[model samples]
Target: MTKTFTENDVLKYFYNEVSKLEKEKIEDFLSCNNALTEFYCELLTTEELLEGKLEKPTEKTIQNILDYSNTLCLQN
Candidate 1:
């Protein structure tokens, strides 16, 4: 049976979450479809941009973790 791919499939492909067969299928699909090719490129560019923009835990959060660890360590 022939499987039709969706944008979600493209996302799975982007994240390396798809099987080897699916990956090849999506690669073949993207190469043949201009609109999908553009969309995949956009997804890739957005992923690249988001790499450095992830939010780090706040200082308060870090301190809370440290305090919690200290309490656990003291009890041991």
Candidate 2:
């Protein structure tokens, strides 16, 4: 038996981890469910914003890891 998509599927869908059939079901449900449609729209908007908002690591952090690795290699 196939499982129908529910509001909970929204999170998996947003993460692009839903199966193709499940995605189709989710789309179908969103088309007819007004509350779900609004929620889906908001989720899509948030995903878009998050995609381009990655934070860069500081140079000191990178140097610290490299220094630690060098010390471990010397001890070994």
Candidate 3:
């Protein structure tokens, strides 16, 4: 907690990719600082926003893939 932690460390913690030691240190630091806690919340919200975003293919694209697969199956 005495040493400085960066925003990148916070991002890493949000993604659960931090080491146990680093996560503990970040949590300890965040607990005492209201502003940092708020920022962490923002980071969590941002992460949430970035989740579950799969691109939808057009109908023609889907048809094309199916057609290609059918051809491959016929060849085999």
Candidate 1, lDDT over the whole model: 0.90
Per residue, candidate 2 scores C-alpha lDDT tens digits across 1-76 of 5455666787788778888987888877778789878888898898899989999999999999999999999999
Minimum summed lDDT over a 10-residue window in model 3 is located at: 1-10
lDDT of 1 at 34: 85
The order by descending lDDT is 1, 3, 2
Q: Whole-model lDDT, candidate 2? A: 0.84
* CA lDDT of every candidate: 0.90, 0.84, 0.86
Against the true structure, whose TM-score is highest?
1
Off by over 4 Å in 1: 1-4
- Candidate 1, poorest ten consecutive residues by summed lDDT: 1-10
Tens digits of lDDT, candidate 1, 1-76: 7667788889889999999988999998888888888889999899899898988889999999999999999999
Clashing pairs in 1: none
Task: Give each model a TM-score.
Answer: 0.69, 0.60, 0.60
Q: How does model 1 score by TM-score?
A: 0.69
Please name the candidate that would achieve the greatest lDDT relative to the true structure.
1
